[model samples]
Target: MIGLCLGLAGVVWAQLPVSSFTLAWDHTVEKIRWEEDYRLTETGLVLEEARVRGNGAGMEIPEDARLEKGSWHYRRPIPPLQPLSLGRTPQAGDYQLCVEGDCHALSHWVGAPDINEPAIQLWTCTRGGDAQ
Candidate 1:
């Protein structure tokens, strides 16, 4: 099955069995909620949608953004990403990766981040006997 590979540094540590997932987190500076939906494709990871609950510094609402259910939603026409990087910090809290209707902390896949390794990398991968 196609899923996501979670890695630290350059080594893959864990693989999640999900074709699509929603990543939700609170802005470090704004303390507002932000969510992004992504789907795994043969080419790479495709960003499907993005939403922000109350914008602040660095969270600019796009001209095409629509306010719905107290959040600004919009989509960007960007090419597929080979790998996606996310910053990790205790102060910012854990990143919630939701698949289907369930959500889990990203640490659940790869464990806590080391002080020296403050970032997590996610990419499309196929899972069988091993993640590739």
Candidate 2:
């Protein structure tokens, strides 16, 4: 079975039995909400869609983005990534990983990161392989 793996420093920390999830966070500079939906595949993770409440600084809404309610929605046609890297910092707050309809802080799954650590890696892995 395919699942999502959370790791740090090349070591797998947690394997979630989920095929799809949403990663949400606040823009560090803009202080606006941003969310990305992703699904796990045999080869890697696929980003389905992305939404941002407001754009500023480095967060610019795509020209094809449509205004839906109070947010801008768009789809990025990027190829599946083997491993997705996420930056972590106390100042930016924790990332909310939403599965099904429930959302939880990423730290809840892998514990808090060390100050020296800079990023958390996410990718798809087979249950019997690198994932436990």
Candidate 3:
């Protein structure tokens, strides 16, 4: 029994430098979609450059950042989740980890449609920049 206990202890001690949920995220949503409710589970976010995805659109955005989707123009805020350990499994709510602040869309082309509606899209660090 003692030997088994020591083995377990050794295993735990072997895995060092493990961090807890240190990263959290936040977001503000301004969209017109029906699923007003969403979760944060996909972290690799980017700003401006957005492409169409399955059910809805997906963008690489930062933590606590806001983005617009669909056409309803519904507005809401998205909160970040706790940081998942290196070996831990992440859930749906664990994906919203990114930098904070506004992520604006690219400037319109010359003589383009004038929506006048500014939508802050989601984004993440592309070059491992600051996370504040």
Mind giving the per-residue lDDT tens digits that candidate 1 earns over 9-101? 546788877889999988888889999999988778899999999867999899999999999999999998878888886666789899986
Per-candidate alpha-carbon RMSD to the true structure: 1.9, 1.8, 18.8
Residue-wise C-alpha lDDT for candidate 3, range 36-125, written one tens digit per residue: 222222352112222221122343333443345532222333343222121111221122222232221112111111234221122221
User: What local distance difference test score does each model get?
Assistant: 0.83, 0.87, 0.22
User: What's the TM-score of every candidate structure?
Assistant: 0.91, 0.93, 0.15
Ranking by lDDT: 2, 1, 3
lDDT-superior candidate, 1 or 2: 2
Which ranking of candidates, highest TM-score first? 2, 1, 3
| Higher-ranked by lDDT: 1 or 3 | 1
Better-scoring candidate (TM-score), 1 or 3: 1
Lowest summed lDDT window (length 10), candidate 3: 1-10
